[model samples]
Target: MIRVLIADDQSLVRAGFRVLIDSEDDMVVVAEAGDGATAAELTGGTRPDVVLMDIQMPGTDGLEGIRRITADPDLAAVRILILTTFDDDAYAVAGISAGASGFLLKTTAPAQLLHGIRVVAGGEELLAPGLTRRLIARLTTPTPPAVDDTTFADLTAREREVVTLVAEGLSNDEITKRLFISLATAKTHVSRALGKLGARDRAQLVTLAYRHGLVRPD
Candidate 1:
């Protein structure tokens, strides 16, 4: 089963999330915290596969908690999905830079929330398409200098192609069709590219690509 931790200041919110997650046969909530600091503590102790973290908490806030958890080498395997009611672009950037896997508006449906948890846990990335486009646009507003080739020196030719396709927002299935590769091959390439670039998820990779001039807004 996929082990999950719910971190939010509101007790009702945690209870609601727990009910939805527990209903899934393939997932379970292993712990819950009302603040980011406690969430970090629970993550270290529970070693949950995924953490649903609220952005606004009484203490240590979500972004700081994300930074702390990700900085720990032993707890690095835990994937953090930021749960927020706000849709501010700067907040999104902050969370992504702090190593959050993805951001989801709290108004999202229960099914979408569950799917996001599974996707992040499976080492895949999840971003709401509209929000994703806005995020890319925000990052590309002031074009940065050209990326040095050395930035991608570690990637093989195939891996570079995969990263380029990912920057174009192609899903694994679409990538497979375009590249004439098997599903598993596409997934492998995506994973390899992420590791080489030190990206936590597709959202981060896309931002990096835009910042490095790997992709551009139309």
Candidate 2:
């Protein structure tokens, strides 16, 4: 089962999420916290597979909690998905930079929210292409120097191609179709790329791709 922890300041919000998650046969809410500090503490103790974290909590906040959790080697398997208001794109970017698996608007449909949790728990990045492009572009001011080829010198040309498509927000099935390769091949390429890049997950790979200029904002 995929264990989840809900971290939101509002009791009603936590209760609602608990009910929804408990209804899933393949998932469960193992714990809940009303603040970032408590969330971080529970994560260490419970070691949940996924955390649905509210970005704005009373203290410590989601960003700091994410940082703390991601920094702990013992919690490396935990995936954090930030919950944000519709207009809080900046918070989403910050959460991603701090090692969150992804972010979702609180208004997201129930089906989509469930799917996103599964995706993140299964070690996939869940980004809408347009939103990702915009978020990266907005934060790319005073652009850093393009990542040197040597940085990815370990990856084969085909693997590099696969990584680029992943950064473009394509799913493994999409990559398979785009490259006319088998689904297993696509998955293998992505896995290999992740290993070579030393990325914790696909989201980190996407961030690296952007920072290194493999994928341009435009």
Candidate 3:
């Protein structure tokens, strides 16, 4: 079963999410926290496979909680999914930069939310193409400048292509199909890119791509 932790300031929201997640045969709610600090503490204790975090919380906040959990090598396997009421892309970007595996609005359908949790737990990011474009648009105000190849001087041509696809929200499988490369090759490329870029995961890869203007709103 996929173990999950719910971190939200609202007791009702936490209760509702608990019930929904518990109903899933593949997942179970392992713990709950009302703030980021407690979330980090509970996370260290529970070590759930996935954390459904709220970006806005009373004290400490979910962004800080994500940073704390991700910084700990012991909790490196723990994946965080940002579940919030806010529909703003800036908050989503912040959460992604802090190490969240995905971001979804609270109004997301129950089925989609459950699927997103599964995706994150399975080590896949949950950004759709439209959401990806919107996120880029939110960052590049007037226009995203041309990509700087010098910014990626360390990446080989193949690695650059792989990282670009990743920032475009493509999965390893999708990238393999798109580039006509083997699945293992795709995975290796992504791994190498992460190491070379010092990225935590695909989420941070997207953030770095944004910084260097490698991926634009499309």
lDDT of 3 by residue, 65-177 (tens): 99899989999889999875545577777788788887887788899999999888987788744466666766665777788788788999999999989887788899999
- Please give the ranking of all candidate structures by TM-score, highest first, separated by commas: 1, 2, 3
* Cα error, candidate 2, residue 95 (Å): 1.1
Error of 2 at 62 (Å): 0.6
lDDT of 1 by residue, 49-104 (tens): 99998887886888888988988889878998887654556666788777888888
Q: Candidate 3: where is the Cα deviation over 4 Å?
A: 128-131
lDDT of 2 by residue, 1-218 (tens): 99999999999989999999999999999999998889999999999999999988887898889989999999999999988875778888888878898887788889999999999998888864446666777656566557668778999999999999988888888899999999989989999998898887888878888878787766
Error of 3 at 121 (Å): 1.3
Query: In angstroms, how far off is 120's CA in candidate 3?
Result: 1.0
Which stretches in model 2 have alpha-carbon errors above 4 Å? 128-130, 142-147
With a 3 Å backbone cut-off (N, CA, C), the pairs that clash in candidate 1 are none
Candidate 1 local Cα displacement, residue 131, angstroms: 1.6
The superposed Cα distance between candidate 3 and the true structure at residue 135, in angstroms, equals 1.7
- How well does candidate 1 match the true structure in TM-score terms? 0.92
